[model samples]
Target: MKNIYKGLILSLLVLGVGLAGCSNDDNNPSPDGKDYASLDDKLDYSLARNEVDFLMETYEKDADRKYHDAELPTKFTEEQNVFMQNALTINLNHSAPVVVLPMLRGIDGNGEKVYYIITEASDFKMAKKLGVNYSPKLKYARGSEGVQKATVNGDGYMVFEGSVDFSPVRRIEPGTGEFAFPPSVAQPGAVGDENYSPIVVLPSNLVLNATPVKNVTGLHDRIPEGERSLDLDEMWVTLQILDGFQGGRAYYYHLVTDAYDQVPATIELGIYAPKLGKIPQFGQSTLDEESALLGFSPVGNGIDDLQSDNRQGLSSAILSDQNGSGSLAPLDPINVFPIEPQNELEKNNNYSPLWDAHISKWTDEAIEKGYQRRITSFQDLKSLVDKGWVVSFTPDAGPVNSYVAGLNASNAIINCPVIAHPKN
Candidate 1:
C-alpha cells in the first residue's frame, strides 16, 4: 500500500511539471492577446495624460532631430507624428504663446491606433510660465476632419496631420503694395457653381498704354479658415504665354487690385524683349541706361525668368543667329488702317477693365526730369528715342545684364534704377 501511494505521487509530480512547461511557452498570450513582453512598457494608456514629465523630457531631448529627419511613428499613425512635431515646435518658440498637451490615444481612419494633443495657443500666462520673452497672439480655426490647424503671424494659418497645406498662406508687401496670394481649394457645391477667376476693378481714370491682351486672367484667391478676404491694396505684374512663341502667340499680364486708402493708381510694366531683335543694337543689352526713345528700356525675361543661381547666356546663340534681323518682332495690330505697323506696341493697344483714368498724372519731379511724356500710342514710344532723351531700364543683377549683352551687344542698362511710376 505504501509503494502504490509513492507511484501515484510521482505521476502527479510529472503532470504538474508538464503544465508548468506549457505555461512558459514563448507564444503564451496575455489578457489582451499580445505577448506580455511585446507590449510597449512606456504606453501606460489607462492613465489619462500619461506620464507628462517623462514624455516632455523625451520630446525635449529628441524632438528636433526627429522633426528635422521627418521621422514617422512606427506604432502610431502619421498624423500622430505631425501633432508631435507641431507641439514641440510651438512649445520651443521663445516668442510664441503656446503649451503642449499630453498624448491622448485614439484610432485613425484605417482603425489603426494613433496619438494626438490639444494645444493651448490662447493662454498668455502659460507662455509666461514657459519662460517666453514675448507673448505672441494666436488665431484659431476649426481643424479639418483628420488634421490639426495652427497659425503663423505673417505666413497665415497652416493645416497639418502628417503633412502641411499652405494654401491659406497670404502676405502683403508693406510699401509696394505687392500681394502674395492665398489660393483657394475647389469645393463640391450642390447649387450654382460659386467658383470664379480672380478679378480686379481698376479706377476709372487710367488709360492702358498698350492694347491689353484680352485673355490675360487674374489669380484665383481662396479664403482660408479663421480669416476674412483681404482688404488691402495689392498688385501683380506677370507674363502669360498664349499658345507657343514658336506659333507667334504670347503676351504680358498686368494685374492690379483696387487702390485702398487713397493710394493713386500706377503701373509697373515688366517686359520681355529678346536680345536677338535687329532694330536694337546687336550684342548689347542693359536695363541700366535710358533708351533714346522710350523712357524705360523695353526688355525683360519676364516673371518666368527669375532664378536664384542666375541663368547665363540662355538665348545668345538664338538671338545671335541672323546678326540682328532674327530678333523678335513687335506685336502688330490688324485691320486698323490709319495705325502704322511700327506704332503697333502691345502696351498701348491693351488696357485693363479696371482702367478708367484717361490722363496719367505725372509727378513734378518726373516732368522736370523730362519723363512726363504722355504715352498715348506706339508713336509716342518712338518719339522718346527720336527726341534723344535718356530712357531708363532696370536689371536686377549683373548676370542678367551680361546675358542681355550677349543678345544686344552692350550692357548699358545693367545698373539702372528700377523704373517706377510715382503717384500723382
Candidate 2:
C-alpha cells in the first residue's frame, strides 16, 4: 500500500513538470523563432530613434508637413488624405493629425505647469479646416462649474475660464492588493472644482475632451527639443516619439507618460488618457465600430469595469511593483503597444490614435496557486490570461457584473494612438 501511494505521487509530480514545460514553450516564442519571456524583449528601441530622425528630416524637407500646423500634407494620395480627414470629422469631429499640441493651463502648488490637449471644435467648417473634432454634444457640457468655457484668443490660442489644480500627489500603491479591489493607496494628482472634468465646452459651443497632460514646470529643459531618447529617469519616466504609416504615409506622435484617473505619470512628455469613457463623446458608434475599423479592441475586461461603483480594475502599471517605487515608478511606457499584431502585415495599416485598453487584475486563483506576479509586458499579461491566472475582457458587451456605472453606456476605452509597431 505504501509503495502504491508513493508511485501515484511521483506520477503526479512528473505530469506537473510536463505541463509547466509545455506552457513555457507555448508562450515565449517571437516571430523570428527567438524565445522572449517579455514583450519588451521583442521591441526594437532603435526604431523610435529612427522615427524621430525621420520626423526631423520630413520637417526640414517638406515645410507643409511641419508639426505645428496640424495639417495633412499633400504627399499622401488624395483618397488617403480624404479618408483620414473624414475619419477625424466623422469619428472625433476633428481634422487634425493624431498628434496634437498641448496648452499650458497653470502651475500647481508643486510649481508644475498643468497642460491640456484639445480634441474637438464647435463649428463644422472650423473643425474641418483646423482638423479638430466637432461635437454638438459639447453644448451639454457647458454652463457647469466643472465644465469651463473656452475661447480662441487673438493670438490663436485657447483661453479657459477655469483651470485644473494638478498640485495633488497622485499615487497608487498596489501593496499586495487583490485585482478586483482598490489598491492600498490610490490618489489622483489633478483635481478640478466640484464639477471639473477633462471634457470641456469650447467657445464655439463644440465639446472636446480637454484631457490633462503632465506638469512640465522644468522637465522639458532636461531633454531639449532636438535631443530626446527612450531614457528612463529615477521615476522611470521617459519620452517616446512614435511613428506610424497609414496608407504608406508616415505620421508622428509624441508620447511622454500615461495618466490614469488623474495626475501626469511623468513630467517630461505630454499626457493622454490611457483609459476611455472617462469623457463623453458625440456618438457611441465611434467608440464601437470606428475603433474596431481602426484596429483597436478592448484589452482585459475591455469595457466591463466601466462602472466605478462595482469593480475598480487598474492597468498593469497601477497594480504592479515590478517596475519601481512610488506612483510613477512602477509605470512602464511599453504597455502602450498592442499585444497582438506583432508585424506590419498583422497591423494592416489600421493604426489609429485609439489604443486597446488592456485593463487587468490578479485572479484569486493566481494568489492561491502562488502565481501572482507583476505583469511587465503585453506578452506577460497574455500568458497569464492563457493560464487562467488573470482575467481579461473587452467592452463589446454591456456591463455584466455591475448595476451602477459611471461612463454613459460606452465601455472603458483607451485613446492612445499607435506610434509604431514593435516588430516594424
Candidate 3:
C-alpha cells in the first residue's frame, strides 16, 4: 500500500512536469515565431490586427488615389510646392484636422505638411510654378469618425473623419459622469437593450506627443501621451461604419482625454451619422428630464449590498403640486419583485417601473403644461424646463434628482440621444 501511494504521487509529479514543459515550449517559440520577451517582435505579431492593418493600408491607398493620384512628385521643388499648398488651407480654429496630406518627399526624407490643401485657383497657380498639378478642392467629405464593429462586411467600407474640439477642456473632464443614461434611473419595464449605449469617458484629445506610459500590458490599453511638458491640444479620432448602418451609430468612443489626473470628465460634443440623427449631448438636464419623464422610480435595491431588501424602491415616488395651489401629492410606489433565486444571475438588472411611469407622467405634464424648447448649442447642454418638457441641455436641480446632479455639480468645476431610440 505504501509503494502504491508513492507510485501515484510520482505519476502526478511527472504529469505536472510534462505540462510545464509544454507551457514553456508554447511561451518560447522559435525565432521565426512570436518572441514574448521583445516588444518589437510582438508589434507586428497579431492575426486579428491583420484586418486593421489591411484596412489602414487600404485607406492609405484610397487616400493616395484620391489626393496624390497614386504618384509622388519627381522633383524636390514640386514637393515643396505641394507642401506649401497644403499649408495654406489649414483651419487653425478647429480643434481637429479637417484635411491633411500624406508625407511629401523632402531632402530629409518623407515630411508631413500640416493643414495643407489647395483651396483656390491662386494656390494652384503657385503650385504650377513648381510643375505640379494639385486639386483645387478636398476630395473627401469633412465629417465621419465611424467605427466598424461587425465581424464581416459584404458591403464596401464607409469611412468617417471628424475634428473633435477639446478647446473647452473643462467640459470634457473625466469623472463628470454625464455621458450616458443615468444608471440609477428605475428600469422595471420592457426596455430594449438597444436603447442603451456605452457612455465612454476619454480625454478630449490624445496626447500623441506626451511622454508614453511604460509597461502597458497590451497595445489597446496604452495611451502615448506625447511629452509630459506639452499640453493635450488635439487628437486624431476616426470612426467607421459597419454592416451597412444596422450595426450602430458612429459615436466612436465614450470619452477621450489626456489628463493624467484622476478626476472624471465627459465628452459632450455631438456625433452625426445618417442613421443616428444628431447625437444629442446628454447632460444633467437630460437626466432630470428623463427622471421626471421616467417618474422617479427607485433603482434595484441600491447597487450596494444585494442581500439587503430593496428598501430603495420607495424613492421612485414623484412628488408634485399637481393643482398648482401649493399642495403637493406623492405618487404611489412601484412594487419591485424580490430577486428570486432563479434570477440571481440577473441581480443587477433594473426592475423598477420608473421608466414607464416617467413616460406617462411626462406625457401628462406635456399635455397639462405644454412643452417648451430652449435652443442651445453643443457646448451648453443645460435644459430649460421647470416642470414640463425640459428642452435645453442645462443641468436640472429638481427635488427628485439622481447622483448625476452631485457628480455633474462636482465636475462643474471643469465640464446623447437620437430620435430613433437605439436598441440594446
Candidate achieving the largest TM-score: 2
Number of clashing residue pairs, candidate 2: 22
TM-scores of the candidates in the order shown: 0.17, 0.42, 0.19
Query: Which scores higher on TM-score, 1 or 3?
Result: 3
Task: Assess each prediction's global lDDT (C-alpha) against the native.
Answer: 0.19, 0.33, 0.19
Query: Hey, what RMSD does candidate 2 come out at?
Result: 24.0
List clash counts for every candidate, in order. 42, 22, 55
- Encode model 1's per-residue lDDT on 43-93: one tens digit a residue: 111111112222233334433322112233233233222222222222212
Tell me the tens digit of each residue's lDDT in model 3 across 159-262.
11211221221221111132222222221111101211111101111000101111111110112221331211221212111000111221111111111111
Model 2 worst lDDT window (10 residues): 401-410
Q: Point out where model 2 deviates above 4 Å.
A: 1-116, 119-147, 154-156, 178-182, 211-398, 401-423
Models, CA RMSD each: 29.1, 24.0, 25.6
lDDT of candidate 2 over 1-424, digit per residue (tens): 9657534533432222221222222442322342333321222222212222232233323323333233554232423223222121111112222322323343332334444444443223333444343332223334433344444332223344444444554455543633322345555444444333444443223344454444442232112231241121211112233332222222323233333233223221222233223333212323122222112212222112332322212343344333323433332222223222211221122222333233354566665675543344344445666676766333343332211111112233333433222221
Better of 2 and 3 by TM-score: 2
Q: Rank the candidates by TM-score, best first.
A: 2, 3, 1
lDDT of residue 80 for candidate 2: 28
